[model samples]
Target: MTSTKTSLLGLTRAELESFAVALGEPSYRGRQLYLWIYGRRARSFEEMTDLPEPLRRRLDAAASLDRLSLVRDTTAPDGARKLLLEMSDGLRIESVYLPDSPGNTVCISSQVGCALGCAFCATGKMGFYRNLTAGEIVDQVIEVERLTGARLTNVVLMGMGEPLHNYDNVVKALHLLSDPKGIAISRSRITVSTVGITPMIERWCSDDPPAKLAISLHATTDERRASIMPVARAYPLDDLMKSLRRLAHVTRYHVTFEYIMIAGLNDRREDATNLKTLLRNIPVKVNLIRLHPTGSDLQPSSDNAIARFLDWLRQEGIRCTLRESRGVENSAACGMLFAQEPIRPSSTQRRTLDTDD
Candidate 1:
């Protein structure tokens, strides 16, 4: 089988220029191609009208512009759309486009499946398939833009896999998405969510990338967190807090803690107080997410419970917001994205085993 060449969509401007020059095309061709791919949202080489047919053929021969195939699309009653995208390798992932006041927000997946076994996540049940290439990640946005006819103002890496687990590709995708000559979305508008992988967090803080950071911190205490999320055992709350402190000191942006309200689990006033203490000195905002029913062992916390928790936080002067669950009818809720088909086995395959929780 002939493998497709590297895509131009994932390349930096310098890299794109190098590729164009190597192809015997002028340097300016890179900018034109970039605009064609991103600005015009062209899917085929034929859409690049200004380029000569021979050059277009050369480009087609050299690299593939295609990355994802839209396998299924479902629109929620609330107007949210979820897409199940099949990669070239036959691995499946999901992306969601949600309408907001000013613009739309696209929630993109970074991997085929998830490695972090968060108790309440349906995608976690699917297990880790593979990390998405930068081109595949960028393609999700391009496809969403095509469907909606509006530029994506906000991007959240809170889909199928842990963004920190697939750090390199996720970073590459961010650079591609935020490139001025490409999508040009502000880094401030992009948020990368992680399950608190300590080393990567430390590295990210030290390197200081422009995008915002969000930690999936369902519990404040290590023991309780470990009970719900297996990742907590690897990177305990104390260690996670140390890394968060470094991130706070270095970056001006406020880190958001995603606290999923699971009914009869971690919904007490004491839990809220513990959360306040945990984030006491750190520059942070709390996003209270009501658990979406995934037919899992966990149940959603009641609205009254969520209100009580928010009331406590507000009274304590912590910046907090109750995030409304969108696309619940479409299985686009937090940690719910997974392809319906089976993944093809590979030599380097990693399986996701079922957990009791």
Candidate 2:
């Protein structure tokens, strides 16, 4: 748009309808516009074929698509594709497409870089850049879908930043993505992963149709969790668990606990027992992830350690599964994929394309 007009990419369906009515157009035009932007992945106002030519031209001058600029799209041999999406300000973020059987997943970032300095995460090591707007967040899904030519069956906000840190924008992006009039992905298929921000979890319980919740619960004890995840100090496990229990009761959903199995650190048999005790009353499922190597000294738990932990969890009646590693060779696996080029030169291969360009 000529005068720094806002991007329509991230607006909820209601907002689009309101915008259409404000433009002296019929309300149905909003749904049409919504379908064009997300359902059809329209890149420009001119691409909305159903709209009248005059209206399209008017929109061209007053609004913009402002979707992500694709920089580098890398695919590993395992059918996982990682995309480098350049923001208008030149900061970059990553989104990934994983072609898992029976379902394809697109993992997206909610912030340019992560504010939470988790000891084992490559993204947190780069430090915080800025919170991605709702538009930037949704564009990750739309662009990844276009790149892979497959509709995403599941969406995870688990790529770069902790979702709860950028709470409002991430929630807004969820509303936009799950809107049936637009992309129409079911809310049940969306999962928001956070580093256990307790207050935010409590807030999400009131959402009418909340996306499922996933916690990056890498440790069982408060002291141990704080060593790697500094946020745990501010929001301790015991305090966070109170809200988690309430969430399960109110939402009636099994909250996902994502535990990264780290070697010689969190892989102890005692840790699994402690974890089971910690989650005793909470309605939850556990995803045991092998720690992906990062700049930190953390190493993945050995196969024996992993199996022991999985077996223990199952024996204790905890629903747990080992998360399959993907895109390891392309540096797109868990805990990898940061936006800063220098910090992660290989996976961070990116260039900028300003919307004005």
Candidate 3:
């Protein structure tokens, strides 16, 4: 059964101090907790050796350090590890670890599934289940560190859900993750990807965003973007660009537009020119991603098509990069995270954390 006790995983240091004060302990105890839970990576109160035995016992009874149970773990040949984690209520989410050069990066989810039915994303096919708590979000980082034994130098909220849909919790988790007393990841190293939620983009810009922004711009025209991403229909491309222009002006970071190149769909030279016109005055970078298969009839752009597209953008003086697909063999690459087979809803409600069908 899920514990009724309070969970201290996502609490900020000030909140932790308040919790300690409420428990009749000095506020310093909370600061110590900040050290242990994040820095020392303590999983249980018993591991907090510096705390008093009686206080630890009291904490054990009144609080819980609940963790997502690892339901299934897969490692790609490229040393990328994908974890399907089961929450207290049995919902599952995927988090991935990519051991990149210069730094290690962890990609985490903000919600169980997704509501934005993006045609290329496997997670969106599952539909929206629920938003993950701030604790659940932060714990993905903690759990990844424990499982991989690698310090994550970068974080991306690009796993399963559109982070702006779960704005408050995502913002809280961002602060906690970048807090000096906590995981201490640099805000500049963190990026949040969205499928163009315009109002939320404005709100994020106004609130002094902690992480960088990446918006999915698979197609240059509104009609084409709406054809693939249903959310695009709600917020038109023109309005989205206006907000992005403002965001680019206000934020210190350059906006990144993620374009998925699909065969015979949006990879033509004309599309590249249209994209250039669309992002004319915006300070931005383009990341061209070859579409990864997810049971869709759509095929990836040909090598020559991608090269031409990249060459055209570079020739136009736009900063662009072609993202190399990693973890493709194990279904852990971009747009490939789903929890269908990993979660088993049976009479016993038991699930294994090993590789299985």
Q: Model 2: residues >4 Å from true position, as ranges?
A: 340-357
**lDDT of the candidates, in the order given:** 0.83, 0.82, 0.87
Off by over 4 Å in 3: 1-3, 342-357
lDDT of 2 by residue, 168-209 (tens): 888888887887766778899999888887777778887644
* Candidate 1 wrongly placed segments (more than 4 Å): 1-4, 342-357
Error of 3 at 156 (Å): 0.6
Q: Please report, as a residue range, the 10-residue window in candidate 3 with the lowest summed lDDT.
A: 348-357
- By lDDT, the candidates rank as 3, 1, 2
Question: Local error of candidate 1 at 331, Å?
Answer: 0.8
Candidate 1 lDDT, 58-102, residue by residue in tens:
888887787577778999998889988887777778899998824
TM-score per prediction, in order, is 0.93, 0.92, 0.94
Query: Which pairs of residues collide in candidate 1?
Result: none
